[model samples]
Target: MSGKGGDVRELLAQYVTNLEDDVFAIQNLQGVVGAVMARYSRAETGLRETLLREFVKEDKLKLAKAYKLIERVLIAYGDDSVGELEGAHLSFENISMLATKVIEHRRIGGSPIEQSTRYVRYDFKDPERGYHYYCPESLKDTPGEAVFRDRMDRMFANYGRMWQPLNQWLERHKPVEEAVYDLGDMGSTYADMADDKARKVFERTYRNDLKTKACDILRSFLPLATRANVGLFGNGRFFQHLISKMMTAPLAEASHLGRRAFEELTKVIPHYVKRARLLDYTAANERQMRRLVPRLVPELCRSGRDSGIQLLRPDFENMAGALAGDGPVSAQRLSEVWADEEECGFLASLLFTYVRAPFEVIRQRVRRMSREQRLEIYDTYYGERVTRRDRPERGIEFGYPYTFDLVTEWAVYKDLMRHRMGSIQFQALVPDMGFHMPGELEEAGLGDIARETVALAEELFAYLDAHHPTEREYAFLQGHKMRWLLGMNDRALMHMLELRTTPQGHPNYRRTSQKMHDLAVSLYPDRARRMNFVNHDPVFWSRSDSEARQRLKEQALEGDETAS
Candidate 1:
């Protein structure tokens, strides 16, 4: 081995030996040295090797000195240096309200996997454990605690009651294939099959599907305080930002989470995240909003009223059929095409950065260019030839701007909200717009159950709306419709369309994306053609087979059972 490699191996070995004698500290040091080693292996091999050698050969005093030097350098280097190092997996067990806030911290750029309400049965409870909900520390000694606890208990009871009936309904109405398949048809029932494992697998699959539908219907009744667990994976820099924001957040739960997360994270990757601190700006922003909002528009602050989507710009006269009713409308009917004079000006502004000459000269040159030449330039800028490394020139995309007034389901809106490039204004959640029932639930003969559950939730929401308007949204399901006005350029739309139109995406959002694409094409046919990845098809993709294989492997390790 090379001298550098030998030194690394020795240092690692000594570190391990030291950790063996200090088991408690090993947990704290796990991601720190690993992250440092990874970065050094890539770029700072010589410096890393020298530091390791010095620490391994020197006494306790020297080792402490080395650690302090490393800490100072990391803190001084700021976000860029620490951003390169990843954090260890951090586990969070909290209420759904806090989980949503944590997941919505997009600035962290972390990937999080939370417990699925679709697949997991939250109704299972032990008498000793009690119903799962978070109680704020301030509520402990107050009379309001009794009221809060009683309401939460009632919600859980309603949620539990729906499960059994929903399951029975699904079983009775199993698909025709599941009901009538012969012995040879593996795609359907396994009635003639003698294999116990195959029978168990079939039962498990059907049960899971039934549970998913039931949970989807019942989740509308669940309070924001319902307990949830999430596994977060982020880099050290992301954790620093997350910790800072969480600490500065207005919610008491967020502050509690921030402190707890910081304690655990600092133990693992101290150097990378040592500079994390709550920002004064975040607090000031929240304070200003609270002070200014009610004073300026007291009537606007009223709750429980439906704030449906509205189109303020693009001339109301031009919107013929799109703004007719509250129901879903075709994109073609909704948008107004820009006039020739207006379009020319818009296109010039978009191409402003691309022009090499002065503003007036470029304006004249763009006006003179042939239609074919303009199209050619756009094609060359964002074409099939452009690799991931070589993004299209930003100048070409500056010309196409589109805006839409959208009324979509809360679930669909959540997916769209992830696209940060768009300027979106959302209305408060309300059930007056109605809810959507999944086609799968309808197919399984549980449409009535789904509809009735939403109605029940709306009834409860009405009560909360009158008594506590701010908390009424807790009763909203994924199917509940919400309105939002979206304003974005063509470049943002291209990215949104390419992603949301995939076959794997939810059917509702896929329809939304398809409509958006249609609108774009209707207005700017030449530019719309450049967005090549928008897919609209009946095909579906799933990871169920791989998941089944993994389950089988786990089962095999537990016993001698074999999967056919």
Candidate 2:
């Protein structure tokens, strides 16, 4: 075997040995070591060890037996006990049309890293010299196949055609050097470089930024059928729930993906995911909900409207007085205060666990303390927190609440929907709301073509809405507007604002985040003064490009080491 393959085998063996040791330790703790030994002896050590060795040699039995044992114990105690133990991490790749569904199913308890629309350019031709898309099997032999193909082809064609003009327009309109002052060290270094070299670097960055913006707008033209790679890392229990839901989904692609995922997952963690099957209860519930919706509110079911943002509850009264003092608080002071508050809660909860005092008395005593006294107590409790691991308790964040009503493009909504910590309630996905045209498209002189395409999509959406309302959403373009009600606390707001306002974020969502931040500051300027993480500067390259360049550099270093 090659050196690398042998090294990999060694690592695998070490991992398996450690896992087996952990299993044995747990069994001993549970006082089941004797029972486990008895079973192993009955199976005969020679045969059992031989089978295990063969499985290990094949590199397939990492924790299979341990998982099986855990599964058996859990089942014996009742399925409810399964929650006590987290299943093994199972990774999945090449998941496509099901990307949105899988990612948005945050209740399934998994983390998904999907191919970003901002970083990866999907407008290019595939290896097969055709656009990459997910064509439903049901449509393959039907008359609709021709329509689907033609529409997808034209969408990709327009996307490709707009590329050059969009880049050229961006070069003329949004120069990179103009925003160099905002990028700190990187910008200063670039600014100080030789003129010719700086220009070259600047041009590359400009083109990347331009492409991202153009793609953001152009992506609206691409249907949901466009394939996207998504990597999922989640436990078997969550996978079981996800697979069951997918199997019952109305989409043919979802059903196919669910079946394939289930089959593959069973190979690794068979016992834990054995219960993954389509439940008629869930399917019937979905059917009834869909059927009852239109019948109960027929007028609300109608489509066609303009999209925009509306801030519903900007409750600043509670904190307005507290923040009325001097200017915004310093970042250090803000962090100190937050840490202190969280420490107080942590101590209180800890005391509640052991104290003989009545809960109401304890609550009253804590509440009656002077603000200064409380701050001092908390400061002593949390001496120094230089790292995130020493940060404040999560409960402290519940003090700040924010609510917004947003009407943005469907493409932007998809990005925001991934922030599952927030409650995102949305209206129907329809083209009733006028779509957003890409500014680059207008600058590229493809404004007419873009408008025409949107018009065509709108007409088709109208037809679909009237005839097939349930499936009409598939016809809605990315630029189509949809309204959503967002309710989130300060912690969720921090994550959404900081993430969505990054230089690489979609402009539409970036604008939304900026608006949100602006609104928050306006209401509670003192409290939000230190919420300075929002990025308003421009970026030269997408994050994907940056990561790829880093990977190449690392590979070069490895090659040099190997040569030495």
Candidate 3:
């Protein structure tokens, strides 16, 4: 913005909120914009007055004058909160699904829009070999390169080959109109429309439904190597942590992406993201965790079998007085009930982040405190919140936590990971754990083909792992089973269960969501009573029905429903 005059002022006023525009990202001088704005908080004067009077510059902002302030506050004074004052929009295009998932999981506060396999056509397109997949640089020199290429080609080929047959099956079974017609159709305008026009709507919408279902089914065949897009908006602090996390990830793809992201962010938010480097603590901790977890937990060292959705509190409920004081009182709110038992754990949770004391200390203190004290803490923590979206408070890191051992397909894992409000631990997806065979596929007789593709990918994975240990995850079929632990608090669990168990969702995840909800309900019938949104109805061709409802809504909005 040359010489903060009329033109620059008008430009700033016009596009102040639209940070997604490149204009804000490139021209802000990164921290300079945030620094100038942050000054108004500490200053007694208005923004224009602060800029002109305090900075003592009427015409323009000098870099050293404003930039130095941010550097001092953030770097020298060691105030991390200052980093939250600025952020930027970043787009990751045509990256691997693995990379996108890792990014989403690691990211703190960001709205991420990912390329949906349900909506996007998975046709082979562009770049050298007419296939959309990420080939690791590590595989280029190895004999596994041939195996990788062949497996990817075969998967894509089958994905393309099955499209027509799948569509035909959808059309024949999920008919656009019910065969057992009602007399009400005689008065229905949509029913009276020329068969050709009806066919047009059916072809368009049902074709959309077809794309959604077919891709959802065959998406199991998609390897983690398949290229996907993700765009997110995050603050500088978020980027710093996320970048450091990726840099230390198990796969080199994550580290490479992190470096590239760091380089690009330098062009936009250089000062804010300067600390986005490999941290000694992060690398050392992760390396040791990987090395010693098996030794620390003897069960982890051995071959363990899949146990679908087992609630993971070992030697649980043996307490002679476990149920004592668990029953909800007449005056109790849902938030006050520490359903997990022992101490007013839920109430003490609100102080988890704010207090520097250890969580056990807080829990014990709460345990000794009177009922009124815990109630007061609960009210003080959450009562003044305006909306449910206010994120409760800082103490979500602790309090009333539930852990579930999940044996699910890679497809379900990707969907589940979207709820990043909890801690997660997952093992590698190998052929030994097996795949999730959807009933729809088994009924359609393509179940065998899907299994065959997993075997093909497994063979490639074995070949590649033998040659070198890198990029084995890239070979993992999305349907391959892996055991993962999802640890969430009550609110997070409710959100996941209510959302994923909806009829419009994929059947596989829907079932798991139902099971999670059922488990919660069985465990705490009183606390989870309000969780009636959990859909336990029979699901079949849900996309078809969902699309049909959408069509009716569109017709009503367009006034076509009133047509003669």
Clashes of each: 1, 3, 0
Which candidate's lDDT is highest?
Answer: 3
lDDT of 1 at 462: 74
Alpha-carbon RMSD of each model: 12.5, 14.1, 9.8
TM-score of each: 0.64, 0.65, 0.77
Instruction: Tell me the spans in candidate 3 whose CA falls farther than 4 Å from its real position.
Output: 1-31, 46-59, 125-127, 179-199, 295-299, 314-399, 545-564
After superposition, candidate 1 runs with Cα above 4 Å error:
1-51, 58-66, 77-79, 175-194, 293-407, 413-479, 483-564
Q: On residues 1-564, what C-alpha lDDT tens digit does candidate 1 reach at each position? A: 125435444445444444223332222234444334434534544433433544444322243544554565565533255454546678888555434644554433576766766667767665875676665554567564565566656656656765676667666766423642222223446474467876666556555545555665555445556677878888776777778777876566677787888899877666656666775654654454445434432333443323333322333342433266646765544432234334333344334322222222333444455777555444433445432323332233333367555667776676676675765544456676766666655655556655665666676567667765545665566677766556578788899989988754555677888887877888788998789899866432222233344445655665664433
Question: What is the alpha-carbon lDDT for the whole of candidate 1?
Answer: 0.56
Query: Could you tell me the lDDT of residue 539 within candidate 3?
Result: 74
Question: Model 2, poorest ten-residue lDDT window?
Answer: 25-34
Local error of candidate 1 at residue 145 (angstroms): 2.6
CA deviation > 4 Å runs, candidate 2: 1-68, 79-99, 126-129, 174-210, 314-400, 460-471, 521-530, 535-564
After superposition of all CA atoms, the RMSD between model 1 and the true structure is 12.5
User: What tens-digit string does per-residue lDDT give for candidate 2 at 512-562?
Assistant: 888888877876677555678987665434343443344446546866999
